[model samples]
Target: MLRLGNPGRRISVGLIGMTFVLSIFAGRLIQLQGLDSKVYTAKAAEQRVRPEKLPARRGAITDADGHELALTLEAREIFIDPSVVSAAKRDQVATALAAELGVQKEPIMAKLAAGGRYQQVAAAVDPTVAQRIMDRDFKGVGSKHRYRRDYPGGDLAGTLLGFVGSDGTGLSGLESTYNKLLAGRDGEQFVETGLEGQRIPMTGGTLKAPVDGGSVRLTVNRDIQWAAQKAIADQVKAVGARTGSAIVMDVQTGHLLAMANAPELDLKNWQKAPPEDWVNRSVTDVFEPGSTNKVITAAAALESGAVRPESVFSVRDNIRCADQVLRDSHPHPMERLTFSGVVATSSNVGTILAAQKVGDEKLYGMLQRFGFGVKPGSGLPGEEAGLLPDWRNWSGSQRCTVAYGQGVSVTALQTASVYQTIANGGTRVTPRIVAGTTNGEGVFTPSAPGARTRVIGERTAKEIAGMLEAAVSTDGTGNLAAIDGYRVAGKTGTAMRYDTRCQGYCGYTSTFVGFAPADKPRLVVLAVVQDPQKGHYGGEIAAPVFKKVMTFALKSKKIPPTGTRPPAVRIRAGE
Candidate 1:
């Protein structure tokens, strides 16, 4: 084995082995430098560069005439890298940021003193203030560009406008409903960053430009909205109610001009409000429609040819419906009243008599046609399709009660739509809040009109309108809903509100629904006050609110009163 034989052969093999090893190394070098160089280079660069987000601007929500309800403004998200700042300079830097940003120094100091590479100092800071902090050029202090959602009206349409979160996402209300439309596509920018997530100055990388979101134009009118909100808020407070809602609808369009609620959410400080107050109660909360549903029963009777406006009924103070006894709103001697007068008086006994003529199926069918048991589709989030049990399943009392808007539930928006149907000549138009949307290029595209269905005949609607007009007459239950110099038409509702906590009827839901210039119907306004401590009657509580809001709306729109006299309807047989 130690023969040292073939020394020349061994030497050649050794050289060949060395060459093979070197060839392998050379091939690897070529692959790294030539074939996959871009891949490797990118990996190396990726370690050095970090991606930064470029937030897109959220869309503006405007009123009908282009008044801003909600809008986006440029802002800064100020953050800090504590490791970069020296201990001695921490307080000084924190002080400067706090002073310039108008924030308390203690919070900034607490954040700065913490041992970390990064921490948020403040959010939604003004750009100008952020710039001032940057001018100092303190180490570790940085500001990122972001959009801040601004509410110009504060709590004006707070419940309707909803609010945005710190992460720039819509959280509730219309914000949540049309979030995709309001939130635009975000973009990205790559910048050279150090190992500590700090952006290296002057080393620019690729950018993907952001696309800003489109704007939403609502059918809501600003002045009218303000008036409605004020009126409802005042009335709710005056009545000491748990909550209240008011709605104003365009008779011809079914467009919601103003939807107001009490105990409204403040868009500025939405977090401070109770979660229950966040919903749009106009379309969310449901209660027995009470006398407001009488119109539906009347329609059934007339449309089925079971009764006429002139048909008379001998109505007593109280009538028995199944095992339960139903009574008129007030006690009175038996009187001979025409069908119109029965409605004008809001007599449950009289209404039940009329419903008997229409029968259960016919009355239920009429209610369905008028949009009961269906959501109003007002484009507002949290809207409910109120409870309407099948007529066949109705109880003995419920059968009669449903005729006068009892043992059934309906939302304020739905109640208003009932009046809108009559006001619009028997056409039921789905309620809508949004008027149009504007694209990034500032081109506005109008929204398609709401779906319209004829729920009652024109003749039937006119007859109901006349009856409603009689309700606002001097002797009717809704007389207080009358407007000076204008023939007003409406109904009053005082329903026993079903409170879930009590598991029974607890308080009353006062409601007054009406349209002005009765013959020339322009607007339908509904006022509802729930669980009030002061008063419960619709005429006493809700009607005044309607008059106040309707008056403002009429003058606001310059809808002059039609000077024609209202035709007299016989309430008494002799008359």
Candidate 2:
């Protein structure tokens, strides 16, 4: 081994090396302890400080006439933090909470004794009950205010307005469709806390206030909605039909004034009701449109220049399409009739013959233009765009069958839209339900206005109006739909219902779709009753209801009568 001559110098150098390492470790400790506050502050905030959610108020739903349909109010929720209760007194707390909350004592005792740090027992208690529970002064029990939705209209527009869920979210109807606009942001608070997680004194917390949601204004007219609901309820109950739907739209604006369905539900308590009652059948359900679809065929023919109101055809003497023989309800063998006469009698044979002249291409184009087989874009959830088989997909005899409103399907709103098209001078507009919003200051911010798209020319629309008028005259087949002092134009539809039993058509659906004051129309009303007991004819079951509703609607609106008489048509020997 070699001996070092400078032992003192070597010792000093080693000591200096050790001192530098210790200084480096001390500097790192100071950096971690003092330089970064966000990390330590966040860690401290997470351990003892409990984050509390700031509740927000939901938006309101109003009618076009400024009537409140749904609103939200401040409500209280009672809860218990079981950790705060002493083990000896835990039984007492459980018993008191169970009786006050209407729950069994055993469950309450089990929950309190489970020893979870922050356990909530009962929630959503009304203020009276919440106050009573708080009066006990139980260490663990407490109450907090929350926003609860209320529907003042009750079942008036229940299905349309829809209901909200427990998480303060919109679940259905206008609520679900406009949920983003209805749900407000959640605000939170972080407070410095003590040993038992109790908020500390002199330590201020951070809070961000919640922003409430915007309001929704609907196109519904409350008075008209009430009247329509009453009439439909009375009729549906009288006839004993399974269920019914009534939809009224502004003929001029294409705005859905009222869309009502039965049986109605209360939005406040949706859990107690059957799931099926929550459906808005007016837009979601599809059925064979029946003769109510005749207007479509007639419009196609007139617009395509294939047939005229005066054009004549030989009504079936029995026209056969594959296995089905297309015939009028009351066959007048080899009956000669004009295009207008075909619709007046709702002659299936005549409509099909006219469809032959118009053909599939023109008919399909017309249906597409009129918004059939497609969603009305009303912004409601679960809206089914009724099935419309492509013209190319149509099989043997399919074209003819589709002519008289068969081999196709549509929703009530789609059927009504076709009539609203004619009533609005051939321009089709989107059907709307929500009107616009109004601030708490009573300043109304109307929804973006609807646009008009021209579907048929002015002359063709006028001729179509004249033909519809002729159908409802005292001498015509739809005379049951005629109203006194008003020239009403409408069609009655009796279509066979779809059956899954034999996997073929089984029952029938009675439908009436029409607009009033045919000369200068203002309102378009559509009512559908599924499977009436005895009388199934649309003319019998649906037309009179249509008249009753139209008469009341006109009188209610104070609309003056159209003094002009329907155009006269001369019958030829062959026609």
Q: Pick the candidate with the highest TM-score.
A: 1
1-575: candidate 2 lDDT, tens digit per residue: 99867988988999899999999998887887878767888787788777678776778888886678888887787665677778899778888878877888887778777876666676566678788887877776767778778888788878888898888788888888877776766677766666554557777565887767778889888877777777777777888776778888888878888787766677777889999889898888899899988888999999889899899887764678877676677747676788888887788988999998988988998888888888987877788899898999887677887887888999988898899999888998888887876553446677776678899988888888887888787656678888878888888898888866658886678888788889899999888888778678888877777777777778777988888786775332352
Give per-residue lDDT, candidate 2, residue 302.
93
| lDDT tens digits by residue: candidate 1, 1-575 | 67766989999999999999999999999999999999999998977877888888999999999999999999999999888888899889988887787879998888877878779988788898899888898878888988899998889988998998888899998888888888988998888878666678889765898888889999999999999999999999998999999999999999999999998788998999999998889988989989999999999999999999999999999999889999998899999999999999898999999999989998888888887888887768888999999988999999999999988899999999999999999998888899999888789999899999999999999999999999999879888888899999999999999999999999999999999889999999999999999989999999999999999999999999899999989887889
Model 1 lDDT on a 0 to 1 scale: 0.91
| Per-model CA lDDT versus the true structure | 0.91, 0.81
* Model 2 ranges with Cα > 4 A deviation: 1-48, 86-110, 192-204, 331-333, 438-444, 567-575
Instruction: Name model 1 segments beyond 4 Å from true.
Output: 1-47, 104-106, 194-202
Q: CA lDDT of 287 in candidate 2? A: 91
